[model samples]
Target: MNLSLQFNPELFRDPNRFCVYVHGLPEMPVAWVGFCRVADVLISPDAYASQAWRDTALTAPLISLTVTDVCETEGEAMRAALRLVRMYQPPINLRSGPVSSRSGRKVMCLETGVTYDTAAAAARANGLFESQLSVYLNRRSTGKIRGLTFKRV
Candidate 1:
């Protein structure tokens, strides 16, 4: 028996929805799933490239996979998804808030030209999102900040 089968979410999303399939090795592909509105804040583990392939049929909750892990192996990618879900699930309360909350409105309070990959390290170092850039800017403090303009990337 496949023990991994128990961990499968069996979640599904519509085919027409905006989806991002971060390709990995030929044998492994990780699909980041969500609507366009919440493209920045939330994502779901919609599909994976296994020996057998399948697509989601209805939207499930956001799975919160990080951009940096986009290239990891299939197992690593899924573990990362579960880690992110455990990390961000409670306070953000994706299940309880209005649909708009998924748009990063309640979470991503700051914006910069910094791509997700650029600031991910700094954000992780600070134990927060890149929003700290705004804090540095507002204080007029000299910091390793970049992208002066503040709009969603």
Candidate 2:
């Protein structure tokens, strides 16, 4: 599917060749808005455990995405991440209203939790597939959480 994201047009022109970052809704740094091939980063369990996700544990009770979303195949997750980045903006606030993409894909932002499951659940409900959420989290797959283990916030 062609997400047709508008942030970095040239970089995403060829979705098959590059990796993209799209997770960390609450902590996604503004500086990460671009295309890159540095798909070597890994989001260790300890890395995803954040206060933001925990803060909304009771109210949100949702996930952002899942292991399945990013582990479908090689580079598939990257493509998904690019789709997310193209569709949404920074600091994904789960408490806000839904945002629509040019193609009419509406994604409800979620407060980032401390665990992968929570993040995935929230993102999955919004619009993202279980394919690329992990790529957005770690930049690359470490294959450590194939079973999708996460620490509860």
Candidate 3:
């Protein structure tokens, strides 16, 4: 019931395809992510205590049991994931012609050194897998913006 959650997204070229972890997991540890009435972000208390989490899966998506509460569920996880996405949105500064309308090809125009987070990459709740949330908010501004053009990237 009690768990700790830590988000250490993979360091691969594409941070989206990251792994997740559920900390303080008993024989059967579960990573609960939904929105908790108490804390907006609750990770497993002992999830970060594991050497495996630090050494091996440090960057992997970790879920600590200590982050759980009386009202927690996958649904709430989705909500929290979405809420995080909204909160972590970066400033969009379109620079270039109308980009395409593809999925991955669609690139956003964030300031240099600014990148999306795990939760922001996840366009929706379904996109949030385990503890690693995908960030996709800074997507290029597409469509006619006050009578402008739109594209993917």
Best by lDDT: 2
* Runs with alpha carbons beyond 4 Å of true place in candidate 3: 1-71, 89-131, 136-153
Candidate 1, superposed: residue stretches over 4 Å from native: 1-112, 129-144, 147-153
Candidate number that wins on lDDT, 2 or 3:
2
Question: For candidate 2, what is the lDDT?
Answer: 0.34
Q: After superposition, how far is residue 38 of candidate 1 from its true place, in Å?
A: 27
TM-score of each: 0.17, 0.21, 0.21
Query: Which residue pairs in candidate 1 have backbone atoms (N, alpha carbon, C) closer than 3 angstroms, thus clashing?
Result: 12-56, 12-58, 13-56, 13-57, 13-58
Where does candidate 2 stray beyond 4 Å? Answer: 1-24, 27-29, 32-123, 133-153
Among all windows of 10 consecutive residues in model 2, the one with the lowest summed lDDT is: 144-153
Instruction: State the lDDT of candidate 3 residue by residue for 3-39, as single tens digits.
Output: 2222333433544322222343333222224433433
Ranking of predictions according to lDDT: 2, 3, 1
Each prediction's number of clashing residue pairs: 5, 22, 41
**Model 2: number of backbone collisions:** 22
Winner on lDDT between 1 and 3 is 3
- Model 3 clash count equals 41
- Report, for every candidate in turn, its global Cα lDDT versus the true structure: 0.26, 0.34, 0.32
